[model samples]
Target: MKKLPLIMMGLLIFSLVPYVESASVGKASIDQVMLSLGESVTFGDYKIQFADIDQAWTQALIKVYAKDGSLVTSKVLPTGYSLSVPDNDNPLFYVRLAWILRSNQKILISLESELELVEGDVQINKNDAYNLPYKFNDVVIPAIKVKVTNTYENKANVRIVLPYETITATIFEGDHYAVPYKLTSDFQYFPYLYLYLKNATTSYAVFDVYLPKYPTTVFQLGEGGAGGTTPSAPGAEPTELVYNDIMYEGENLIIDINGTEYALGLNTVGYYSSFTLFDKDNNPLKSFEVKKGTGYELSEAPLVVELINYESEYKRAYLRVYAPRGTEVAPIVRDPKIEVSVSTSSTELLLNDELLVFINVENSGRGRADNVNVVASIPTGFELGSEIGTWSLDTLNPFTEMPVLVYLLKPTQVGKYELGPVVVKYYDERGIEREVDSGNPLSITVYAIPKLSVTGEAFNGTWGTYVHTQEKT
Candidate 1:
């Protein structure tokens, strides 16, 4: 039995040794390494070589090779420019040229391996510990551990345990704490761990943590070209407008330009896709065929319609409509739908009587309403008595209602009068100013008091008035 226990222990130790040896220690990184022409330096599986330099010394050709001595990539890197190995999107490493010295025929460059960043959200109970795993290329390495020690009132106390030291921090909701840690055996410390407390309760807490597998180095290059002006590099594309929604077949996209509403409709027949422009009354103005991923400008208007993609089975077309020639074109999208209501304390009142008017506004859409201005029309027979004619609000969030706007109005002349259709002007989330009316007007009736007068003559039909003790009949 004793020999059997020892054999099992030996087998367990043998199983863990290969896994420890197979784990990667750290990422390869070098900075400001000077290499002469045809000279190469090896970093892990990739080798960087200074292949050739142009006669003007403005550009140099660099080549990268894999460990099997096979060429991987060749790029002519300009001074002060960088080349990402493999490609820019999923770059394994980066090669940045610092400067070219004609005097010594040498090029200064730097190589840095991409750091692997891992981020996730963890929900932990109070006094429970969560181990944060550091991964490099999907292989787990040594990392720190975090424990939620205490949580009170919207704040959480956490303890971070590293291989060398431990740290404690008190963080509120939406607060983040960054701790320096070493991912490898090397002493280089990096702010490799980030803890963000998203929400915390008395019994439990939710937080997000960000961990990087390796440390990084930032290099500052000197000014290049004449007068410290860097020439524009090639392969930079201009930014194009992106479309968010996919329009279905037979759908209309309405655009408003300088008080005119132009409707653009898309319809596909067989293999052909056509966009038709129509007036506000649905009268067709012009129609043109647009290919996929191509832009077609309307001859009737100064607008361009780009077809991003088309799905025949789903009858959907992804399109982007804009003004290509710098013409101002505003597309009519879903905005903050604001509805207003106006009410009064009493519909009928006497002359000089004040009427209490209440105006309420609500946003029923997903967009926000900004710079809202409410203008109550003062009728011909009434005048404002208390508040100003216009009321302003800085912002009204979506699905929210503003406080009732109250104003007093006194009837100037006694007659049947119409009170309101309060005009509301505001800017939507797109900064486009829009106007809306209450639509329902309040009808009010003001009555004037009757006057009674009597006169008596003392001289009996002589139209002369005499007082004292004598009574006139």
Candidate 2:
């Protein structure tokens, strides 16, 4: 497992995201909300609606339309995500309940309307003392309560930004609006929540903060100056722990070896985690917990550990794992080694000449890649059609390569041109995704075809004589 610098890893992850496509219709939508899809509903200042969403996946491309029949925005909305139109006084929109599908790539629409924003009636008690920014005890899994200035309109645009994600929704005003969030144990970062009141282009950002979860002390051991469970802050937030890395159960994970030190710890608030260990060289190894027959481990060295639940059923158990003497633990993500090369049919061409571009994708890694796509960038001013778009391969096995005719175009003007720097995106067996850019763009020169009729004098050097031809036309 080659190590990547922290900054490089972040940028690599960011670069893998592709441009969103237009959302097609879906079958299943989120229920629980009472509204039909495509039904034009009016609210504050504008009318909004959407086509019935009949699909369900992790991500959905939704195109929103305002009352003017103009596109509001084509947004990639995820499950549990709501986007508030900022700075607009009119808040006519509603997103029906959607059923999420695998890969989180698609969604099932519930109602029949074009995707619209939600609007409805909500009543709040006047006696309640509203807080400016509500504070949550634990962001990882805590209930959130939102308090907004009382508005005559029942539904208002709400925009929220979590540490890892952002969402916009039409808040159905009520006595009080409260939502609960369950943070995944996937990525590590601090929690920061931002909410906004979106009305047209003017948005009033909400204020919110997270207070770390305090541990519930079960008992104490090693009295006096000896040893015992770490001191507990019953009322204060717990400091970030060193052994906070969590691996879920039934995951085929890759473990990267960090510096020379590795340690694992379990908390009272915990889930089951068991895994096998293995090294980068495919070496097998085991952790001490597995030797005692209390946990799960699939292999050695760079082990595959399955984290299930607590050690016992008491709702409280503690365990710690320390990596073998010389290695630290890191997450297993898809690391694809893909190379892209491109070539054009000809280095030179005449105006209006048809040209073809070829792209080659080489997989020099161990993982099996799927959904390999290639897209070419044709130089500006070239005549291109939809056919000069994306090409794909169902799969590219490890140590193999694939080639595609990514683009075909005809030059309409005479000049130098470039075509290439094809972009490649693919997913490995474990759902590790990767993307790559091809080498420099391919270049071609185009010369305008000479269109002329000539009648001139002809000369023969071999004969040492010059002869002029009149009436050569």
Candidate 3:
């Protein structure tokens, strides 16, 4: 009976071991949770609470605490902004305020952790090797070399040669194999390389490699002996490396020089291949079309690319790229100037007379004006007779004038009035709102009609007697 109890106790202890281990290393995430003021939630080893909110709700106060009941940080987070734990450069946890609902007195926040990804796909033929480079500080070194030994239908044999050891595996289609590696002496052995076989044929095989993390420092190999040193000599400048790689059409080859990342994309493959260079933001910096065995130099950015060879069957191009200088470019910005004028058909008019008003809007600047609106003001004694007071155009190009906007107005009362300084509102190309008005208001005069009555009493009434004036006057 005692032996049975002992066995049960041992099994219970073993079961709890994995649970404790998993909890210690597990990653925590919370997707967009709505929390009210003074609400709190616990995730992994951390606790997050919504402490307070401002009256305008534009900002919120958030408090974070560790599992040991100790406060980690208290921050005032703004809408559309985020607060990263331990700073942004090496963030382990993130507390982002997506938005706030003013009507409900609740806030939407998300807690997340940064994910480490180092995955890519490569195609290699039998007996060919692909080199993966590791960047430590400013020094670049060849970290691993992957070679294809053999390939059959749906399976390929690969050899992963590392600095310390070599590993071999047979990967079938849709399956993967992980190889353990240590980037530096201070790190533990992790699954640094994963080879996922996408397709395997007699000639070649395609693999998707995943490297979750890379070492910040590496062992240095020397002629005299093997020793550890800093990435480079003291006060020594970082050096650039020429990277050689093979890529198919639409595939991107990434290179980093002097902490700036550049991507070379093969747009088309032919006798005359075309490639485009992009910055880290994927903005095209330059483009080139060169024949095989020729090179191109980008003047805007200090980079050179040379095409060595192309395989028509595989649609792959072997390329060599390097950055020898710094980038030299400037951005150009243009402004839009709007001019408005108001004109009247006649300055002087009689009562109950109709007048035609014309509004001319023009863009005289170098940029285009968007969402142009023209507004006309009616005089005090005049009423709008034809068309509305407002006119709109989608866009007014530079040095362009819109069609004439004509409206009619009738004078309701006889008086002198001023017809208006028309107003124009528009947005520039940079989404800036601008307002412009006509230089001066147009003057108008309304005069009353003149009435003339001629009453001629031509009477030869010099005397009271009325004589027969047939002959004698």
Candidate 4:
């Protein structure tokens, strides 16, 4: 029994000896070696290579220091002269084993052949090449990576709104134009990356890429532009034209609304005799005429304004007003749809830090605005601090206009921005969710003014002021 056990132990040792020797010697002798970082490099006539299945090989050791060392990897190859090194840092190696001579099939026994370690510290050169005195124990590779980020808003889907009746005239010349328009406070647009490359202490190049241009439309609906037009009332008495109460100095009968001030076409000196004078009480008074000492009288008092009829093609709207019957006011039509017209007192502004967005809500349709919910939806990346009160309009107040204000945060980047389908989703007269009207889309363009800084002294020369190339000692 003891002899049988000893014989079994010897058999096991004999079975492992050949496998261990295979690392130092193979069926054939190595003729050439080509180490690749992540793939196998082809050697002349034969292809001896190995690859990492689960791990990467960062360093490799070849048996021969210059051309004599021979080292084999964990895997064996039938006929090849190459090895594949991975791109990550992991200790792995491969050895080439081929016949240097083909005449005789004499297998050479490479005894205890191990890859030689580097003698001194390795150094890398700028030419992307290396001058190593000794061979590496394992192949080393650098990790490559790719990354991308989205910095632009959806441009093609953005909607831009213009003020009502505001004509945005753009003359395209040479395939480009600089157009100007007002932007709503809730505007949010795409942002692009600006790359700059500099060599040493000098700038080399700058790259400006317009991410993408989004689709946009004019004004929130029923305000101005292609929509919002209607015919004037036939035989309708002229409503008192109450200009904003803002007045300018120097006895000028002009009133400033918003930011613009306008004057009556004629002087207001005693023109009220032919003109009719009426008070809010609908009572007529002769003293209301523009006397020699009296300047222009107040055109009209606070009146409820509403959009009665809207004509899209003419871009006009008819308004019904309950005015005092005593004023001899000439009803001048300013609208293109009718002889009467309207001039807006609104101005476009680029607010970088803060802005006040105003939304006016009214019911133009014949249906009563019961439970009318006007929702102002802003774009992403914008913040609404708090919900200001509703337009304080009574359901009983017929033909009423209510104003809602929203404060907008300034944008960091410059571009065209858009906010909402100002949705006016409310139940119609039948208590059904039947209305699908949208407030006008608004557009705002954020811009940046670049600043240039000059350093050091100057010298006047022909080359547009010679600059010092180097620092003074």
Candidate 5:
């Protein structure tokens, strides 16, 4: 038989359902309860004490009563009382032993003196028979103590409050009426701890410890470095790093990765350090190793970079560099010197032809300069005169002067003419070329060429006796 097509084969598949039922369910489990009653406790004395009547015979005699002024035992009249028959049988106690007792059950112990009758005789006297109900005084208990367990040394005033019936719980700290407890028991004997006394008859109670008022610390973070972290030396010495007897002043700890210190009273888990180191001086210091166990011995002040003095002028005009006062690093002489030149000549000569005019050119200040040149402007109808000696431009240090020489050239024009807009351009120590030109055009007054002629003279000429006049126009 020919094979069916793939699509046809898939369409022809047949399946049977399995006879089965799948089952699944989610489950959960509870962990042990770990309730910490914080760190404070308050308990009052004369708090209601419990007696297991069913468990212990001759238990602390207890009297039970109802709140509605019903008839209950007036006082916890203890067993072993004498009967009417002198030394007869022992007084029978309706209560049994091993019975769990409760405080709020309106129970009063029989041993208390408040239950005593005023009349000693069996006959009721007029004054003692109709007497009012008895009143009982309250009990007072001592404060509880709590000691915290931690790895570091720390001093703290722990607080705790006690619970009471007539009054709400109260707060207490070190020397502040705090209560104490032992971890060995769950306080079954005394369910409530007294916190404070509201009045003569009421008391406040609690079971937790408090640490509300603790010291606060402030610090900066990161790479630019931080404030100082020098710790004061151990013991009783004063240091810039450590401040004692100051409120909230902790040892300025410089902690590296995983560094540790033992605190005074409490144990503290170490926090990972932020890489910021404190800069003792505002100045930058060279790289050095900072050991973890050993505290850094920082300079009390910041590093300083100063400019001593500048010496070179030409190769460089401004001379200023920085150097650390007492460190190995040298100071930098950024852009120090400035070069300048002034030309005291005009571009156009305003003088008569061949007139000689004296001009002065100078560098004027302290700066290196070179490539000096000078030229004189000649007006129309002027001619070149003798050349002056060449100006020497060997070198011009700071505050030095250089001169150039140029003889006058005749002016060709009668109007204003420029002698020299003397252009002085030179390279600074940085090898950067700079130029400066200075000149106001010079004005010249040219007079017309003078004419010399003979006016008259008696002369013997070929034309005899006539005044000899040779007039050539």
Candidate 6:
């Protein structure tokens, strides 16, 4: 029984050893933030590299040093199916992503890493073979990496041909690209390597590879006029994975989450998708027009926004905002259609008589209205009263109406005056502010007040000479 337990313990540790991290855990946390660029630090099995930030006064892009593998949220196997990285930190790391706001304040971050301790560091020299010195405990170093630089003006297709190995490279002009190559056998001695650069498609030798009669090099598509092929690198394996060129999607307003596209900010309303849309950053736009091609930048990353309409026909909804792809959201339907009507107490106004104006505004749609204001433009002949011909309401429920009355008096000698159409502005079901034209211009006639003169002919059957109080009545 004792022997069996010991055997089991040995097997358990052995299994864990392969996945067990070979590096040391290290972290450097500070209250202050560094604003300089090109700063770097190494700890445990990780190296953090920071580049200059242009968009912000003090910002840095922290890149973790991981070659050929990724740091996941947990110690689980890489299942490339799920697009989301769990918002966890363990074997994986999570960077702090924040809201859509800009300020002059500074931010501080503490970077942590796991780096493998080595007796010596990796190195490469100019015009010579790579000198990668790796140390292992009494065993052989299994892998080596070399990054070749482009010394020419145009970006040429580079191929590394070595012992039983073949690798093609696509690097920016005058920039260096790294390649990791594994060895079949343990490192016994230094091996020779060869490099070749040529036109990518034509296989035409733009320049002859300067092989130091040491390591051999790579192969390509076109062989005509190109340098002779040396022996392939050792233990070379053909790869199904794509390298060299990067693929980009078209302008369908799609946000690229990793390599896949997650489309947003559209609905099934087809032609009715038109509404005043605001981005996560910018405020309400001037143009009220909405169309398929319209877009605003919310962020360069994958994020969703909660949108609340001020006074539109559509209800408040969460939208994955960005340039929209072909996919769309549900159509816009005015649940509570709003309508406004206007009328006058009397079409004709007698001279020295006041006029009463009545306006009936209703919410006919299914949704509610928050802001509703009615204003009447005074006719040229009439003077405005204390109300200023304006009435405002805070809210109007669907299928409800509010009546308003405005009194106007002192018509400036009106012959025939036409009052302007009343304007009713309110938010529709979507919280979109929209104004409706009420009744047409009102026409009124102002005639002088009639004068009545009465003479008492009964001046008296009696007191004829009585003092006739005939005064100006």
Best by lDDT: 1
**Arranged by TM-score, best first:** 1, 3, 2, 6, 5, 4
Report the lDDT tens digits of candidate 4 across residue range 235-279: 122222333221111122222333323333221222131233334
Candidate 1 lDDT tens digits, 1-473: 01123443353343221100113222344444556777776544567787777666666677888769899876666554556675555666667664564544667665645334355468888999998655555545555688999986467899999777899998777666777554233223344566778888898888776543333322222222121122134111111122335666676777655456778887773245787899989999998887654456565865656565676765767666643222233443446889999989999999967899999988987567999988888888887788732376667766687768888888888899888799999999889999999996888999997798877444434443444334543
Query: RMSDs, each prediction?
Result: 21.3, 22.8, 29.8, 40.4, 41.0, 26.8
What lDDT score belongs to each candidate, Candidate 1 first? Answer: 0.64, 0.40, 0.64, 0.28, 0.26, 0.37
- Model 6 stretches astray by more than 4 angstroms: 1-335, 388-390, 452-473
Poorly placed runs, candidate 2 (over 4 Å): 1-334, 385-390, 393-395, 428-433, 457-473
Residue 64 CA error for candidate 2 (Å)?
A: 69
In order of appearance, the predictions have TM-scores of 0.33, 0.29, 0.31, 0.23, 0.24, 0.26
Off by over 4 Å in 4: 1-352, 391-397, 436-440, 455-457, 460-473
lDDT at residue 445 of model 2 (Cα atoms): 88
Candidate that scores best on TM-score? 1
Ranking by lDDT: 1, 3, 2, 6, 4, 5
Residue 365 of model 6 has an lDDT of 58
lDDT of 2 by residue, 1-473 (tens): 12333554354344323211125221111122212333332222333333334233233344455557677644344433333331123311234323232321223322221221122222233222223233222212223333333332333444344434545555432212222232223112122222222321122222222222211111122123211122233211111121223332323333234432222322233443333344444443443343211223223322222222343432323332322223334443334578888776788988867877667778876456888887666687587743532266657765677744556777878888777677888887778777889867777888989999866565443333566554566
Each candidate's number of clashing pairs is 0, 83, 0, 51, 87, 50
Taking all chains together, the TM-score of candidate 1 against the true structure is 0.33
RMSD of 3: 29.8
